[model samples]
Target: MTGDLVTGLRSALSIRFVNTGTGPCTDMVFTVGLPPGIVLLGGTDRVVLPVLAAGRTHVHELTLQARTPGPFDLVCTNFSYRDENHEPVRVTGWRAGLSVRAAPVVAPVPQPTGRLGVICETPNLVLGAWDELRILVINDAGIPLEDVMMAVTGPFSGAVPRSRISVLGPGMMARFTFQVNVAEAGRHVPLTARTTYTSGGAVTRTQVDHLTVAAQPPVPPSPPPSSVPQSILYLAANPRDLPPLRSDEEMRRVKERLQLARNRDRYRIEPALAVRFDDISQSLVDHQPAVVHFSGHGDRDGNLGIEDNDGRCTKVTPEGLAALFSLHSRTLRCVILNACYSERLAWQLAPHVGHVVGMRSAIGDPAAIEFSVGFYLGLFDGHPVPDAFARGRAHLLSRPGLAPEHQTPVLFPPGPSW
Candidate 1:
């Protein structure tokens, strides 16, 4: 009863009817009403069942061709048979016994049968720069192919390169070149390639080649600081008249993990808690820390909540935050907003800072704590900002039964040395 239907091709279907009565059946007429969009190959829809004994079955098989591209239902419209007493019985209104769907005009190409091969040649790639890559496609099936097309995709600035060949004989090959670039500095970036060709009157597609784009050595910062410990300014804001948070615990875990890092001696943690507007500016002017981290509540409008003069919840706009960072942009290398809906602020601050990390959405208490711990752990181990961001994300993912929202933090303006 199950078969495939293709455009402009005949498809066969079979249906069975059982006689469960205790007596034999005679002079039975079976009629199937075919919906529009399909035509019977034989131009007839009725079949005669001469006789059927008890506990027996009769199968009706036919071939149908689709005229247009759509689905149609086959229904049993008429059934007349003589019962055990030789009395005629009629049945109707049996609808939608089976469904047939015509294939689309452009059917999906079949998968390649291990007949093609691909090899990629790429040099060591640098961040925010372009490099040349070569791709070689081989016909390993020992057969000729026609209308062969190949394409290479990557995180380049614009559209990737593609090439085509009319014919590829047995043991033949083709080569294509692409200018690929990756804007971010990370351990790996995926590059993919796809090929489509015709072999023996069949259109086939080769599997995409998943390749990795590696970054070169990072550019050293201007007069990079020595191995001496760098200071990180930790700030928290919560109104005195409102509910309290686990901010103290989050900071403690971060310090604990930093102490356990391989290079524990390379960091100086500074705290400027219960932060107010003046406190943020004063700390930046006095401490001039390499990194600044804020842990507090944030609103949907991209505003961070800081304490007012009376220790009441006060929302600060992103513009104000960006302006404050701009004043001290020279000394501040990174800013981390460990608060909800901070991505909007992160985008605004990216231009004024070397590195920015913010949460895209609300994060759970445990997730926020784990992320901070992992981030500092990476910094204490001498990892760069991008690597540290990835380590923090990995830490959240590594936890058991963690929700997807826990991975909401995102890094911006990538490939910075900080």
Candidate 2:
């Protein structure tokens, strides 16, 4: 089940966030109007809110649990208090999941019945690498699927590999995958499985299984070093469990919710996108990646906030970062900062990275993540930076808390060297 709600509303919700004690504020709001019919209107009625703010962000976490499905029109705006000189001050906002359809519990997938055998297209008996394998899932049941989920578990305490699968249908299979690589190699290994399926937006059904992870062949030696060039490597790092500032006893309840609410196998939309934030320079260093993405909290000065293995945050200094990549032989094609106040980062990194792209003003977490995601996906679909930016803007502006005319992702073109 997806955990984010995104919509579009550029004409309303103009409430300025008054953080009487901060440097600047990033207050964004929006509204969404439903279409002809198809609205999320059923089952366990409850409202899910996605708001983004800094130290004072949680001020608006008031719960409105009664949710009714319908065509909802959302309005969002940024309210900034004018200075004594009437100067416009700035603050960063973290509006993530606003674009997500708040209540994902509604039956989006078709339903299924009887001994439904979900064929996984994922490879069998592959090499045991650090990364998990991708599996292609096809729903072979005759019925339309709805709210379908699955897991890969084992008997022992260590062999529990549980995860949820997204929308699947008759002849409308999804390429779902999961990895539970056994640290100790063996034969006929069992991967216990359990599934929960909502009957055509009504009832919930389940399934279970015991699978295997065949051993791998001997490690292959390095290939011959030809005169050819090196291929690019894309790395998405997730720092899910931010080392708790408090002890486990104090966070036992909070921690359990964290674990339950997560579909670890899938990319998540959280306070920040840990996937991109955890590994910033590694993007430029290891992969010599043609493109780099930094998604997290930031300030107007290009200062990025990142948590290390210990969950201790450190803002990367601009000049120091520029020099870090300078030692690398792999020249970059471009660098994207999908964090708040990333525009300032783009300007600072322009000279270091070959092509730079960032937002001129601060952006919400969800919008920033969506914007960057759309950009990369568009690239694979063959759109250039400027064109991709337009596509990104179209998607970002459509989210619930963003203004249709919001100035997002300020870009810096490729250098003369390109």
Candidate 3:
């Protein structure tokens, strides 16, 4: 039975009883035990079936009324009747239990007089780790707010809290929380949040908050190197209908490039969630990678393409990308985005990560591959992120017959190296 039971309402339950005897039976009696909060309203627990023949069945229904919200049970404690030979027989039937919840409380939307207010309660500054950003949006205008969308840009990565809300009643408020991760330790990293919504058949957008990032105490020194090889996570997605990217060749080249680094004792590369977008976080948590690399297509508007369940291209917004990276900000030292127009993502990720590299504009396939190959090669050679990025660019520049369009990859916020 449906368990959303409201007080003072009647609920009905039906039970089936069957007899498999050689002849008809008589004096049928069935007793039910009901738990507290449920009372029999119209049906009796004991029922008389004057005659129940062989291979026959009977259905018994009970009507009950709930007194309050709680769990209730209907147990058949005893079933006694006479068999074909006039012998006494008894059987115990199954019990059914259900929980009831209080009716939901809904508040009406108030009318506003033209004031819309927003407040953000976030840490004054964050360093070298992830934190939460809580914001409250109030519908102070006289009209109701609909289709609200929020965007946050800062040194963080992941989904923005309450990115899209269906409605906000006038004078009512809604609270949203976002995860903020800081990759690099610094002072005064600027953050901006904005909200756009439809009100009274018109669209309006406003900047919600201006925040800052601060440096935290440096992380403790690493323990003596262990025998385990350092893992590098490489995530790639190329959905259907888009120009085919050479991801397979790219992975092969990545292994080849890392091998050339010849530091097998220290680093081992691993491919994660080849084309699955939902498994990205699970892969990160399972691997705890030191470096994270994403190879996919990116749009100028800050949406990165990842495959949906149907293998179709699905765009993940900049805020979502940033929020995802924040989860691994502690272990992730560097990130590489080998996709076209990923600079926006890089900036959003730079604060919570040690280093981030993204493309300034569209980059050709050949150039993108070379850049990734060179970057990993430099890393294996003990070069820092800046040096690795430079090496990648240099390798692209040196490629034979390299096109002029290949030099779009750029590193973000080039000062105070991590």
CA-only RMSD, every prediction: 15.9, 33.5, 23.5
TM-score, per-candidate, Cα-based: 0.47, 0.34, 0.50
Q: Which number leads on TM-score?
A: 3
Cα shift from native, residue 5, model 2 (Å)? 76
Off by over 4 Å in 1: 1-221, 414-418
Sorting all predicted structures by TM-score, with the top scorer first, yields 3, 1, 2
lDDT of 1 by residue, 102-217 (tens): 56567654443455767553424677767666666778766778788887777767776778888987767576667766665655767788887787678564657776655665
The residue-level lDDT of candidate 1 at 414 comes to 43
Each model's lDDT comes to 0.78, 0.47, 0.75
Where is model 2 more than 4 Å wrong at Cα?
A: 1-283, 404-406, 414-418
Residues 1-418, model 3: lDDT tens digits: 3334566777776767677878989988878788877787877878788789889988887787778887777676877889999999887775777776666675554434565565543423456557766556777676788887777776565554447788988767666667767565665666676877776556465546675656565557899988898788889888886888887788899898777766756888778644666778788888899988888888997788988888888888888878888778778888888898897787777766878888878887888888888878888888888888888877877877664644677675452222
CA lDDT of 341 in candidate 2? 69
Runs off by more than 4 Å, candidate 3: 1-209, 212-215, 415-418
Candidate 2 lDDT at 286 equals 45
Worst 10 residues of 1 by lDDT: 107-116
